[model samples]
Target: MKTSDEPIVIEECYAISQEKVWRSITDVREMRLWFFATINSFVPEIGFKTEFLVKVEDRNYTHCWEVLEVVPNEKITYTWSYAEYSGDAFVTFELSKKENQTRLKLSLTVIEDFPSDIPEFSRESCIAGWNYFLGERLKEYLEG
Candidate 1:
């Protein structure tokens, strides 16, 4: 297991079934609607390659990640990397099913050997960002 000294975890609870939540997480078309502005290609199968393009502050941030593991309706894990930053990330999404509703827990661990001159990436910003992207965006999108 890879744990980060600089931790990043964001969990979002959904008032929905586990199957619906799983579809929201993995269904490429629905995902592109909420998560990524443009996910060029996505397949949940392990070893699949994917890239996403998102615009923030009028700037385009290209996401380069790979599907690493998939436990059907249970969890999805992936590795993320960015060219600008010299770091790798393992993002895991764990789902807990309920009779009436389900909850999704997301944990992202980032490893960065950032130069001292460069500022450390703000975990606060990252957390809030995911909150908006996954919680507000995806969750709301699914509820509707």
Candidate 2:
């Protein structure tokens, strides 16, 4: 599904255990190790919110995520928006077991209402970035 200017949609699957992968994501300590530069806090409960200071291109940006849905180590959904920009986007993490390995899929949807300031919200870039983060950084962190 296309959202305004976001032409690309990313679909990436990671191989890991549900419990292990869930920790990598919802656990604040584990998230700071691979996901964020500095995470303020991580509360997995639904409706709970958290913010983090992320550095992209040498610029520190404050991003906030509101937990939308949580199903233990099975799935988690949230809406993310950066203070430096506008528009709220949805991100969903789905976990499934496959041959004793957890198959994790992350889906990001750029809300139809694109960010006003950050007009460079290209879905293709988002896809590639997530691929490196979830598929690479998180993967390597878990493997190690």
Candidate 3:
């Protein structure tokens, strides 16, 4: 498993336009379909913020997110942290058009160290969660 010190980056290309990909990531309606279903609201503009609860087993994680940067259909960056945890991280999604496809690169960088003992905070767990969300859930939602 990788340490939290190293940023996790994952890239995938979809047979879709950059505008479509951007909408899926930035728009609350589209985001709810593939990203977080419980997301109450989301805006691509900087300084926008939202929080939602996610339950896993008996543990509840209150996910707090703040949009830090936005570049129309090309890029977006935001802070992702749990209200119940001490760690802080930034998650950025970049989109680029290639012919008839859009390539998306997702990067997660940890600024403050999270509790290492928690299974959910493990680097491996983070990677798996992203893979399931972006590589599987998002992919299926866009393709299917």
CA lDDT of each prediction against the hidden true structure: 0.75, 0.75, 0.89
- Which is the leading candidate under TM-score? 3
Q: For candidate 3, list the clashing residue pairs, or say none.
A: none
Number of the top-ranking candidate, with lDDT as the measure: 3
Off by over 4 Å in 2: 5-15, 116-120
- lDDT per residue (tens digit) for residues 34-54 in model 1: 987587777789999887666
| Candidate 2 whole-model C-alpha lDDT, 0 to 1 | 0.75
**Worst window of 10 by summed lDDT in candidate 1:** 112-121
Q: Evaluate model 1: give its TM-score.
A: 0.84
Runs in model 3 deviating more than 4 A are: 1-4
So what's the TM-score on candidate 2?
0.84
User: Which candidate do you rate higher for TM-score, 2 or 3?
Assistant: 3
Tens-digit lDDT string for candidate 2 (51-111): 7776767565678899999999988989877776666788888878877677777777767
Question: Model 1 off-target regions past 4 Å?
Answer: 1-6, 58-60, 114-120
The residue-level lDDT of candidate 1 at 88 comes to 72
Tally clashes: model 1.
Answer: 0
